[model samples]
Target: MTEPLVVEFEVDAPRGHAFDTWTARCGLWWPKSHTVSGDPAAITFQPRPGGRIFERAADGTEHDWGEVLDWEPPGRLRYLWHLFFDRSEATEVEITFTEQGGRTLVRIEQTGWDRLGEAGPPRRDKTRQAWTAIGEQFRRACQ
Candidate 1:
C-alpha cells in the first residue's frame, strides 16, 4: 500500500466558519483548473454521509467528484475521492479542523493509492502538489 498524502495548514477563522468555507463555499476558492470540466460554474458539497461532492458546469451539467463517507461539522469530514471521474479508482480523503488560539488548523489526508494500480505513485505525487495549491486557496478563503 502506498503512503497517504497529508497536507496541513492554519486558517484565520474559527473552526465552524472554516469548515463552512471549506464545504459550502468551495466553488469560490477551488481552482477552476482543478475541475473536471475546467469551467465549472459552481462546486457544491452535500454535507452528509452518502451525499455528493460535485461540480456544476455553466450548461447545468453536474460532474461527480466523490461521495461523503462521514460528516462532522466544525471538526471532521471523510469522503471517497474520485476526482479522476472513476469510482473504481477512487481513494479516501479525510479532513479535520481543529481550533487553536484564534486560528483553525486544517489537515487533509488522502489514501488508497494502491487502487490506482501502476499509476499510483505518479498520480499521488501530482495530487500532493495539487493539494498544496488547493490548501493555500482554502487558507486564503478562510481569512
Candidate 2:
C-alpha cells in the first residue's frame, strides 16, 4: 500500500462543533471553486451512512458524487469519494476531529488511490491542497 494523502488543521471550535461544521454544514464553507462542474450552489451532503453526497445542475439534473461510509458524529466521518468520471474507482476519505484545550484538530486522510495508477501522486497532492483550503474555510465558518 502506498502512502495516503493526509492533511491536518486546527479550528477554534470544540470537536463536536467542528465535526458538525464539516459534515452537517459543509456546503456553506466548501469553496465553490473546487467543484468539478463549477457550481457550488448545487453541492450538498447529508452526513449519514448511505446518505447522498451530490450536486444539481440548472436543469434540476442531479449528479451522484458519493455516499457516506461511516458516521461517527463529533469525532469521525468516513466516506466514499467518487467524482463519477471514473466509475470503476472509489476513494476513501476519513476525517477525524480531536478536542484539545478547547480547540478541535481536524485531520483528513485519503487513500485507496492506487487505482489511479500514475495519476495517483498528483491527484493525492491536489486533493490534499484542496482539503487544506476547504478546512480553512470550515474553520472560518465555525468562528
Candidate 3:
C-alpha cells in the first residue's frame, strides 16, 4: 500500500464559511479540468453520510463522483472519490477545516490507491497535480 497523498493549505475565510463553500458551493469553484464531464453544468454534494456527490452535464446527464462517508460541519468530511466514475475502483478522501486566527486551514488526504493495482502510482501523481491546481481555485473562491 502506498502512503496517502496529503494536501494542505489555508483559505482566507472563516472555518464555517470555508466548509460551507466547499460542500455547498463546490460547483462555483471546482475547475472544468477536474470534472468527470469536463464541462459540468452543475455540481453538488449532498452534505451527509451516504449522500451523493455528483456532477451534471449540459445534456442533463448526471455522473457519480462519490458517496459521503462522514459529514461533520466546519470540521471534517470523508468520502469515496470515484473520479474515474467507477465506484468499484474508488478511493477514500478526507477533508478537514481548522480555524486559525481568522482564516481556515484546509487539509485533504486521499488514500487506497493500491486498489488501482499497478496503475496506482501514475494515477496518484496525476491526481496530486490536479488537486494542487484545484486547491488554487478553491483558495480563490474562499477569498
Q: In terms of TM-score, which candidate is strongest?
A: 1
User: By summed lDDT, which 10 consecutive residues of candidate 1 come out lowest?
Assistant: 82-91
**lDDT winner:** 1
lDDT at 22, model 1: 91
- The best-first sequence of candidates by TM-score reads 1, 3, 2
> Please, what are the lDDT tens digits per residue for candidate 3 over residues 20-135?
89999999999887787899998989978999999999999999999999999989999999976479889999999999999999999999999899988888898899889899
Candidate 2 residue spans exceeding 4 A from truth:
none
lDDT agreement of model 3 with the native: 0.91
RMSD of each: 0.9, 1.8, 1.0
> What is the C-alpha local distance difference test score of each model?
0.92, 0.81, 0.91
Model 2 has how many clashing residue pairs? 0
TM-score of each: 0.96, 0.88, 0.95
For model 1, state the Cα shift of residue 17 in Å: 0.9
Supply candidate 2's per-residue lDDT for 38.
Answer: 67
Report the error of model 2 at residue 117, Å.
1.2
- Model 2, 18-70: lDDT tens digits are 98777667678877676566664567677679988887766677777778889
